[model samples]
Target chain A: MKRIESLTNQWVKETKKLHKKKYRDITNQYILEGEHSVQEALENNGLIDCVITTDDGLLKYKSILSKVSEEQLVVVTDGILKQLSELPTPQEIIAIMKKSEELTGFGEKILVLDHVQDPGNVGTMIRTADAAGFDQVILSEGCVDVYQSKVQRALQGSQFHVSIVTNVALDKWIEQAKMRHILTVATALDDTAMSFKELQLTESIAIIMGNEGQGVSSDVLLHVDKKVYIPMKGQAESLNVAVAAGIVMFHF
Target chain B: MKRIESLTNQWVKETKKLHKKKYRDITNQYILEGEHSVQEALENNGLIDCVITTDDGLLKYKSILSKVSEEQLVVVTDGILKQLSELPTPQEIIAIMKKSEELTGFGEKILVLDHVQDPGNVGTMIRTADAAGFDQVILSEGCVDVYQSKVQRALQGSQFHVSIVTNVALDKWIEQAKMRHILTVATALDDTAMSFKELQLTESIAIIMGNEGQGVSSDVLLHVDKKVYIPMKGQAESLNVAVAAGIVMFHF
Candidate 1:
């Protein structure tokens, strides 16, 4: 275990830079803060590079530390942690974790979010995919950077619990997914799409949810085998895309 | 349409007061802005007292305004609109809309949120319920104020599209609901309750979703006829509560 006391410390500066998507991608690492998120990363045995904490960080995460290998622990001052965090109320603990590699052929379910710009929705979808027993959660390049602090917080450490990969070529990813016999069910309001309940999710499937405003891109739709709707019974034009995604994922 | 130009205008001062819950409640009026939200509100022939907008707002929403009564339109200066707005980047238009009455019905589905305080979730849930064709969306007293700007924005005028009532007494509402022969489903992690898919929601039903952290209160649970859960298939323990509700609402 090592200790960092200054915000100017090389590691602290590097950690702060990790907030940028280009930096995260280049380094193959991202920052996730919060006692729960840090603990989940360790407990799930996700790739954890180091742990950062204020004075109280260790106190709050003593249990998590025991679960993680001792060599991975890095303690830093509260000031250092604050400089490295994006949250208004900084968590006592933060973890440097490896970006998840592309995962395939996990199980019966997967999720593909096409250009979901809201980090809150992106993170919530990933978390839902994990809970619904989906094998993986895939993201198109246009979606918010999943490594952003807000997305990580919204995930509540589910980022470590699920298989997630981002910024890939959508058509290539779909091609890889199709090899595993994964059916892609996209959501659209058009008359051609069957109601969600009518779709058979019994086979390995990837449920595609699109942006809040602009819907599924035509390319993604072309890759999908079928289109579905949640069957709106009211005057409102649409459901929040994330909520709609959760509905389909749970049903599948 | 009368125009208000000064930030210090009496109407601007009064409208600014709406940022507080007391003023919003006492007046039974709240602020709504952004082209999309206002258009959604107007296109639906909502209970809007009047609209405040600049020339740009008029241009962006002219199509929607065509559906609104001319008597309810109020043109205002950009300065006045900024003073009335709470968002950093103020939309060109803001509307002072009258709140609807508490809903009482049994023939259609409904959603009751118990003490869920996050404005975004509360708003998203209301909007989601509206899209799902629920008869109404009820907010318990302790939940976030439905008329707040953040909730209003997140709702994206689903507030206008759906029947939303706040400050409700749970027992009475449930009693009125059950009298209509509606199923009341409370979601919990417990296994005995039917998996969300297994439950039938074809008839009148009241599905109660709880707070972000604490689930349906035992008090609310006592009133529900059945408990339901979105089955967990992976390492994650639970999905975000709102996402969970969205999934179940459609599946049922």
Candidate 2:
């Protein structure tokens, strides 16, 4: 196993760059911190490039570390781990993972995100989609990066359980979905939109959720098979995007 | 209108202390930042103690500002506003509000949070309860403080729309609720639990959600009229607590 003690070491500097989106995009790799995430990655064939841990972590997480190949394990000081982590109180272990290939084919149940920007919301929606048995999740170009640490943390290993497709044009995706006889529904509150409860369960479907402030984009809405709104019986203007997405995803 | 430019002004320091939970608890007041929240507080009779804004904010929110009486408006410099705010890019306007009295009587529908520690989750669940048309939200002692800046931000002014009671003891609350002929349900996955979809719609009910890592407390779970779980069809072990709460809240 390799040992890294200095923050300025070549490998340490390179791994730290994964914290930035530009670096992650360029390298096609991201970092997952904490014992739970590292363990999840190790168990789930998560394309792990390396596992970094402190001596204390190595001992504390012996069972989980046994799964890591000697070549993929790196020992570091607590200071080094702290320097590599974005969290204020750094976890004992971290994993470097390659971004998984996006599955190309449409599935029976799909979730499309249109410009949903909050990291927690994006991550939570992906987790909810997984829990609701959605086949895949597609993110438009404007959504938060799913590989970002906060998003990864919130995902809690659902990233491995669900197929996530990012940077797709929703309009084109909707058209293709409709061509395949997949019902495409976007959440909106326009005059023509029906209550979500009225939506019929379909064999193949794509449910599109929108930005925190804006509903689905007008361009995307125009291409969808239907638009539905979650009826609000109280004085609240709207539900959180992730919450709304969960309600819709679980309904079907 | 009053103008203050000093960062260390006694009032500025005192108001800034509201960022701490102890100070807020002692003062029975909390701070809300940004235009939408302040506007909602103004329109909803939120017991506004005062509104603080920058000169530019006074001009920018003229329509909303008109609702604030001259005696309740105080103008401060950007630096002073920043000093009092927890946000990195502090909004121009802020409102100090007295905590609303906890409603003593139970209502037709309610949401209860038990030891749910994330501020965002706590706030979003409250918002969902409001959107779901639930009567009130009760937070157990261990939940994150709803008056914290992060929680307030996530609430999106739904705090004004929903009645929220904090520092509740769930077991006792459940007992009292049962006595009042209110059905109490909790999310769990033990042998005795049934699918949440099977939950019969009731005239009066309280739905209890638990911590992020743990389901409802065992003691509290013992007191509920029914134990229910959201049946997961996918491989994911669990759903985000807020998302789970949303799905259950809207189901009724």
Which one wins on TM-score?
2
For candidate 1 chain B, which ten residues in a row score worst on lDDT? B100-109
lDDT of 2 by residue, A1-252 (tens): 999888889999998899999999999999998988888887789999999999999899899999999999999998889988999998888999999899888988999999999998898899899999997999998999999999999898999988899999877888888899999999998999999999999899999999988878999988888999999988888899999999999999
Cα lDDT listed for each candidate? 0.79, 0.91
lDDT of residue B157 for candidate 1:
71
Worst 10 residues of 2 chain A by lDDT: A169-178
Error of 1 at B12 (Å): 1.3
User: In order, what are the TM-scores of chain A for the candidates?
Assistant: 0.91, 0.98
Q: B-chain TM-score, every candidate?
A: 0.91, 0.98
Task: Give a tens-digit lDDT track for model 1, residues B4-105.
Answer: 677777877887899999998799888887778877766676678888778778888787667666777777877677778888889777778887665554
Evaluate model 2: give its TM-score: 0.98
Q: Write the per-residue lDDT of candidate 1 for residues A4-100, one digit (tens) a residue.
A: 7876888778788998989988998988888788777777777888887755767776777777666877788777777888888787778888876
Candidate 2, A7: how far from true, in Å? 1.9
Off by over 4 Å in 1: A68-71, A104-108, B66-72, B104-107, B179-181, B200-202
CA shift of A111, model 1, Å: 1.5
How big is the positional error of residue A37 in model 1, measured in Å on the Cα after superposition? 1.1
